[model samples]
Target: MTKTQKPLVEDDQVAQYAAEGYFVLEKVIGAEDLELLRGAAQFSIDRLDAAMDAAGVDRIGINAKGKRYFSNMVYQQRPELRRFIFGPIMEQICRRVLGENAFLFWEQYVIKAGDPDTTFAWHQDSGYVHENHTPYLTCWIALDDVTEENGSVYLLPYSRSGIKSYIKHIPIETGDQVCYFGSDPGLPVIVPAGSIVCFSSTVIHRSGANLTDKLRRVYLLQYSPEVIMNGDGTAPHGSYEAFLIDGKVATAVS
Candidate 1:
């Protein structure tokens, strides 16, 4: 199918994303690609579990005690991950959403399996690192079908601008505990596999309880302009580092 004829996002979707802070595109990624991502995510999860076992870290949720991450640096952990995250199809959507020449900054995976109590507290991603910088856009790719019964994402419509006023601090053992930035109770956005939900980082969003028997897998990819800074008045480093420059791996700092 041609690029235009292929199942692609519409202008109204983009408008909704900008105004509502999040938009779900139906069947954007095909089944073959979804299987590939599923395999890659499983491998990454296994490796993370092995590493945690070796380190003796508990796989706890953000709200509960013990180590809350099953895996943090999957992009660096698996080179194959870049094949999906940086795929041409995803790039096309990103370009349209953030304008041409949008650079992918980082990626994170949230894997909650079984009866884990590690709930993801409500908070803006920008608050996790840079609280002062623009959060730009985020693409949440689901490897498995996610429903409200399986810990789907909830977001506030049109609450991105008012998020700053609702910022409140809450302490958790995960070292990253913070209340939701926006108080508005927007509609819950539930998407299935082979689909992607895109949202602004400044948007108020949170993952709900995983009530289903199966696992709930999600990949969070954040993109922004080539130039990036921490929102908390700090410099970008480590995972938040800008890696995509001019739509290519940046080899030089200049």
Candidate 2:
């Protein structure tokens, strides 16, 4: 019943992730497990759209001059998500890539489709965390097979070493703008279903368009040291605020 009693990480995974900033675990979730998580993601997506509509959240514009963000803390609002989030597969991987002391930051569905370039801009995870520490990892789980044809995530080789110079906001339109972590052309990361990949928050990364007929469904679970604090406990800029699954409001890590 103690922390050390929990399962430990494999040496290979730890070594690989440390050197490359990522490691892919194949078939981490079986079909049943994948289905459960997918169901929650689908339902959450629907409920989110509805909630936004009811709030008169314009499909394109902001309601109060503030930007929009989405994240689900499965341990709270979506217990079903716990099956995927804290599964032995993820727990061990996180404990290895991050440390055993790591905990959730937030989770998001980076759903994308064809022709709508709205691909995530290149940016490091730490750019949002604004923290000066380790364990700020982004675990990307693919719900379906990912391939270059449909816009898999792209990573700039060893970009984490240049974290500060790469994380910057650039204007995409007149006045309206967004952020990019780096400008270097990146290599696309394609993995099979049920596999997971981990990256440091400071690693430059982004996704491409979903050009194929299939939807590029991805679950982004971000985590960091459970005890780390970022400025009076507020969400890092560019990340979504989340609520716990039990309907309790989530506070910042601080």
Candidate 3:
């Protein structure tokens, strides 16, 4: 698929994101690109399984029932996946939400099989990382049609304020420094395949158990400004190297 030539994000959408802490873009990815992404995700899953077998260890996030939670996906090795990660339309949205020069901080592939107990606890993405950098943006791309039955993510609208103090560290299979905030603040986000839901890293969000027989797949990508630098001039523990997009740093415009 061809890249979008013009900016996909509008002024009203930016206003909505700032006010609600989240916004949805329907059909942001076309059919062709969506298929390509799905293929890349499958490739990543296969690679993960192979790597685990070679190391003689079970996958860190995979369960015996076939559920999977993989991070730092195929964007590094697959050219097709990198196109969507650094695509023009996504860059436009990131620039509008983050800054003129936002960079790709991290990416992950989250999949929930047809398991009734698969759920992600309520937590903020910012809580999983250092507190020094400004809150970043998380763009969740739905690779499958997401609904309440398939474990769609639930997010709190306008919940960024007073959220930091509520963060509490919790142990999970994903990481030792994982955190949680116990509260159902918002409704589930239901969108179709190829839809993109962008929200603040500080916003409290979680996914429910997958009750449907189909799998729920989502590509969770993050973008941050150059302000992520620490006071001691070092990157945060979970923060990845930023890929400069528009040759400008994040400014205080929003």
Give the Cα lDDT of each candidate: 0.65, 0.59, 0.72
Query: Tens digits of per-residue lDDT for model 2 on 1-254?
Result: 25667444457767756665666666667889888767766655565566677877634321111222233553466666766665566556655565545566777765555544545666666655444444467788888899877778887646344443335445443222345533566777778988777776666677666677655677888866544466556544323333232323243321
On lDDT, the candidate that comes out on top is 3
Candidate 2, residue 180: lDDT: 51
Pairs that collide in candidate 2 are 76-244, 76-245, 76-246, 77-244, 77-245, 122-181, 125-201, 126-201, 166-181
> Per-residue lDDT tens digits of candidate 3, residues 1-254?
23765458778889988777788998889988899778877666677677777777764653323665564646667756766677666767877887756766777787778887677777778766655567888999999999988998988666544453336557676543445444544578999999999988877787888888887888888888754665465555444545554664322211
Better of 1 and 3 by TM-score: 3
User: Could you estimate the TM-score for every candidate?
Assistant: 0.80, 0.73, 0.82
lDDT of 1 by residue, 157-205 (tens): 5554455323545766756556654466546777778778888776666
Which 10-residue span in candidate 2 carries the lowest summed lDDT? Answer: 61-70
Best model per TM-score: 3
Ranking under TM-score, best-scoring first?
3, 1, 2
| Better model by lDDT: candidate 1 vs candidate 3 | 3
lDDT of 3 at 44: 64
Q: Which stretches of candidate 2 lie over 4 Å from their true place?
A: 1-12, 55-71, 131-135, 159-183, 233-254
